[model samples]
Target: MIFMEDVQQSQATIAMPIDRVGVKGLRLPIVVRDRESGVQHTVAQVSMSVDLPAEFKGTHMSRFVEALEHWEGTLDYHSFLTLLDDIVDRLQARSAHLRFVFPYFLRRRSPVSKAGGMMDYTCRVDGYLKDGKLTFTLGADVPVMTVCPCSKAISDEGAHSQRAEVRILTRFEGFLWLEDLIEIGERAGSCQVYSLLKREDEKYVTETAFAHPTFVEDVVREAAKGLDEHPKVTWYKVEVESFESIHNHSAFAVIESDG
Candidate 1:
């Protein structure tokens, strides 16, 4: 049987090139390498795009899904680079971009009780390739306990505290583990938040947070300082947002560096 006319590949009358055209929110179950788990299976919200030349009316959108399917092996920085190369070659585009957004889970033990629990963090890995070069960005949003410095100093008995999210985005040249990034955020906050905390653990976390009070500004600055010390990190952006315990509004701060 003969196929219908190829409209997508037909010549365009407009003759105007499109910068980026492809798919987004394509959810897929992918296997990624993890430092602790060795291999982790998770669903990734993928977005892939490529430049479209004026010569063609449109690109073969199915090619994006095909590329994802043909990729075999652990999803990682090196693999992502190779995948982008394949995409640009397949789509005949000068440049290509890919991003994966997912919730990555890590196991954590309670400080005092030692009870184990899985904690999820918002994470994203993005890459763009052009002119025989590729760049990747790794990002994570970490939740922690934050105690108000002012409240701790002013209050006679107890201090007000809240849950804070510290997000860090960075470009690194060598190997950098997700655990390392998570540790930086946990250390920068007043205290590390735990998913499972017994009575003793709760007391420990509460006292620890009260003793190690911090503001939103302090969280970002502290995280930035840590990222600066990492030799592999060539660039970084740190942001902290605190959900105030007593107030309705939230407090936030950010610090960024191009190099």
Candidate 2:
């Protein structure tokens, strides 16, 4: 057999270096640690990349998948860091990055009837490794219900209510679970949303929201307060968006910690 040319190993003509280059929009099966259960199985949209030096023409793109395939066990903070290190070592790069976006499921029960069902939250995890140091961020988007404070105060018959979403991103010093962030987002709203609700549960949620009418500012501030009280959280950003029931535009608010 004749020897083949390794074009990717050839020196680059351009002098500029690529900061990040690898695979994106790759789907893979991942197992994550669950708060109530021992583990959970889910599919994640994964993207992995490493910095390319100016001397090299291109990185070995397939190596990213190889590194991922070599990884085993549950996906957590420690395991995530290990993956990042593996990418850096395999690619012979100074820095590496990894991101996973997936839907996390939780069981929810109705307030009054106790009917139970599964609810899904959009979650994302990001890891960055540079100079032998690793940084991680966890995020979640939680859906809830909110009643308009202005509408409740001005209206005579009833108040206008709409669905809202609270998104939170945080960097923690120690072990932190996605459930913690999810609870904060849920409590910030007027009332939490449920997948299965009976007539009585519906009445309870509607009345609870009406009695505690809130604005987008209130939702964000409440979430910030929760994060502030947490011991593990070193930095956090909270965002709340309300889909207005009576208006043409949506309302939003954001709060971020200095750290």
Candidate 3:
């Protein structure tokens, strides 16, 4: 057998420590809990890293994949923290970070039509482990419909209504489902958008938006209010971006809680 030299074990010449060193853009299949179903399968773009000491020249990149491959359980809040622990132990590091970005689907029934369709929401699960403490943040991007209040008041014909996205990131003390955040985002808008809408559903949504005209600022404020009212949510950040139909530029607003 030939002896192979491990270059990563060598001492670093720069004498500087790296905050994070690992892999990114790793695609993996994971299962998550669904409100209606028992579980749902989805693909995730995963990124994992750990703090590197000044003595180490580099981290073992292959170890990141190795650890992720061993993760076979459902991806949930508890399991997410466990995965971070596995990475930290495998890398022999003081701190570790893990992020998974995936598209979560929810079954929706169109209003007035009773049509069923799947709605996709971009979600992210993040974990940071340091000093034996773990911090978890869950984020979701929800699409909704919004009407301009100013345009509705002056215009005699119609109002400018467009699609907007509400992004919510929250840190909670207890368990909270992704649907919880998504519902808050949807309700914050003038009207909820559906994937499939028939003629009657379209009329209903259009009338709903016109009746509850709101600005982008209103969306974030409403989302913040929902998070604030929740007892389990310790901290939260809400961002609303509207793709204006009348203008080329998009309107956006952001709000964050003190805690």
Query: For residues 198-236, what per-residue lDDT tens digits would candidate 1 score against the true structure?
Result: 999999999998889999999999999999998899999
lDDT of 3: 0.93
Q: What is the lDDT of residue 48 in candidate 2?
A: 99
Order by lDDT, highest first: 3, 2, 1
RMSD of each: 1.9, 1.6, 1.2
Reference-based TM-score, model 1: 0.92
Error of 3 at 251 (Å): 1.4
User: What stretches of model 1 exceed 4 Å from their correct place?
Assistant: 1-3, 11-16
| 177-248: candidate 3 lDDT, tens digit per residue | 889999999999999999999999999999999999999999899999999998889999999999999999
Model 2's TM-score against the true structure: 0.94
| Evaluation by lDDT, superior candidate among 1 and 2 | 2
Candidate 3 regions with alpha-carbon error over 4 angstroms = none
